[model samples]
Target: VLVGRDIGTVVIPEAPIKFYIDAAPEERARRRYHELKKQGKHVPYEQVLADILRRDRIDSERDLSPLRAAEDAVRIDNTGQSAAETLAQALAILRAKFG
Candidate 1:
């Protein structure tokens, strides 16, 4: 149940089940925008998008423990999916792998 950019890749590479959940940068920015707005933050969507892209680049290119999925990790791209849909997808993976 660990969730982080490098958890599966660096922190615990030997974990039996690892998931690399991802979404389009625009979708990620949209989610962040709504989350910030709900928290009463007045950040613009474009700014959020730029920030996300910049952070992604920095994280992926950093020399120390750069972000990456484990070779055996399950990849999930929930670009246009709701939370429940994503959960269902993960659950299905778990079921398929463990049951």
Candidate 2:
């Protein structure tokens, strides 16, 4: 289920799997910082961190579009995991469900 500020509350059939991908605020900040740097855009790490924190606060505290995971949604913490590891875990979940 794709729930966001742009998505309204509408019930839809055939909703089998729903996953909300998330990362730590600091980790996101760091990734954003590096991506910007790679593009030759100069931005301070502190600024990136602040921007990420601000986004988190707004997302969590929003009245109409607050960010939250569904009760039955599986939470995956990719904080310290590599991309390959995360992908493997997600694939494993799918295999278990379908196989």
Positional deviation of residue 64's Cα in model 1 after best superposition, in angstroms = 0.2
Question: With candidate 2 superimposed using the best TM-score fit, by how many Å does residue 42's alpha carbon deviate from the native?
Answer: 1.3
**Deviation of model 1 at 38, angstroms:** 0.7
What is the lDDT of every predicted structure here? 0.95, 0.72
lDDT tens digits, residue span 1-99, model 2? 365532322242234655555789788888889999999999999999999899888987988657666555556788767779877987888788888
Per-residue lDDT tens digits for candidate 1, residues 5-86, read 9998889999999999999999999999999999999999999999999999999999999988899999999999998999
Task: Give stretches of model 1 more than 4 Å off.
Answer: none
Alpha-carbon TM-score of each model against the true structure? 0.97, 0.79
- Candidate 1, residue 7: Cα displacement in angstroms equals 0.7
